[model samples]
Target: WYRQAPGGSLQWVSFISTDSSVKKSEPAMEGRALVSRDNSRSESSLSLRALGPRDSARYFCA
Candidate 1:
């Protein structure tokens, strides 16, 4: 997962690992944070905290 800042710079964010060996999620970008995670179903879900003024940016997941 990544977030594009106002200057169009892509910042690395939390990473969802499919590998069962890996435990917790990776760290998120500075000033940003992860809010929720739901992996009960086949498809995993991630929710970020409320967006602040600087939080405004285009997000992408791969």
Candidate 2:
């Protein structure tokens, strides 16, 4: 969901979401955006990144 590029215009990167609840009929966004959602309480703690590394990326949720 992120690129290693530093402030350079790049190609369109295909995004994939593992959450079945995350359904998008149509959506478009620009720039760096931190997305968070509490879809299910049972899913309190799970893998944050399935396609890439969670690493030192700073993220937060309510």
TM-score, each model?
0.55, 0.19
| Position 22, candidate 2: lDDT | 48
Best by TM-score: 1
- Tens-place lDDT digits, model 2, residues 1-62: 43323444342222324464442211222223323335466332223333344233432221
TM-score of 2: 0.19
Per-prediction count of colliding residue pairs? 0, 0
**lDDT of candidate model 1 versus the reference:** 0.57
lDDT of 2 at 7: 42
lDDT of each residue in 1-62, candidate 1, tens digit only: 66788777887665656743433434544334542335566554446665667667876765
Candidate 2, residue 17: the lDDT equals 48
Superposed on all Cα atoms, the candidates' RMSDs to the truth, in angstroms, are: 4.0, 9.5
After TM-score superposition, the amount by which residue 32's alpha carbon in candidate 2 deviates from its true location, in angstroms, is 17
Which stretch of 10 consecutive residues in model 1 shows the poorest summed lDDT? 22-31
